[model samples]
Target: MLPPDARMLASQNIVIILCGNKKDLDADREVTFLEASRFAQENELMFLETSALTGENVEEAFVQCARKILNKIESGELDPERMGSGIQYGDAALRQLRSPRRAQPQGTQECGC
Candidate 1:
């Protein structure tokens, strides 16, 4: 069962992926692929078993998630302009974190304190 916070995030239509790490360690697995897959489906999450050591499915997971978010934005389901949407796009997003650098006066040099 998902915790309350996770459930709340899901309710907000957050793009969540449930990743099973250490996929290469089959003998040490506590949960089967079917079980994880089923749980993800029930919880409306994207699922993947990834082996970090092998670098397997790591990039694919991110790519798939980006695709899902892009599709949602394109379908009018996710509005990046909406406050608390958690989406930042274009130069506007960059501009938010950037401020104009003040120029020092001409011939002014700072001595190391």
Candidate 2:
């Protein structure tokens, strides 16, 4: 359960709740789609299931969350510059640092040496 203040922020902002690792175990341990959806509805969260092993819906989950955040920004429900806001690009510089970098081959010259 979330704290009262955190829950209030979550309610005010768009929240996406995802359950991962569905491909590893039997169906018993897996949370069902209906159950997840119900939980999301009850708590006002967006729910999705994904398999990290299979890379299923991984990108979709992020995209959906981004869209929801964008909607909140557009609707004036959230301030992009606000601290603790869930906007993805709130710290754009951190995103640049988090991006994957291409490793250059050792002793390989860029001039076709």
Candidate 3:
């Protein structure tokens, strides 16, 4: 995950979503639905509760995100023809791949915690 100061992709009319997973497990719940919804509303994010096992709101979350992106594209908010438009690998991913850091094998650790 990127650091706090390294986060700026949400700006410039970008559609953002705040999703909470594992809604199917109500017993182990932490954050309530209303709290999440209120945060989403306050921050202008599409909130969804999804479970990978049951596939609850998984499709809906993706559809809502796609719909927002499409709406922006249709309204000339996002120009795909631009050089830096559309999905591309972020600098962090690129640096990871190009760096000299080799993938560590499972169960092997440099620090024993």
Largest TM-score belongs to which candidate?
Answer: 1
Tens-place lDDT per residue, model 2, 1-113, is 33457556654665655554564454656566687778767777777777777888777788888667655665667765666665546465644423334466998654211
Model 3 bad stretches (over 4 Å):
1-11, 87-113
Root-mean-square deviation of candidate 1: 12.4
What range of 10 consecutive residues in model 1 has the weakest lDDT sum?
Answer: 93-102
Q: If ranked by lDDT, best first, what sequence of candidates would result?
A: 1, 3, 2
Q: In model 1, which regions exceed 4 Å deviation?
A: 7-11, 90-113
For residue 5, model 1's alpha carbon misses the true position, in angstroms, by: 2.0
What is candidate 1's lDDT per residue for 1-113, written digit by digit as tens? 66558646543667889999999999999999999999999878899999999999999899889878766776667777677677757776544322323466899874311
**TM-score of each model, paired residue for residue:** 0.74, 0.60, 0.65
Report the error of model 3 at residue 104, Å. Answer: 55
List RMSD in Å for every model shown. 12.4, 10.3, 14.0
Better of 1 and 3 by lDDT: 1
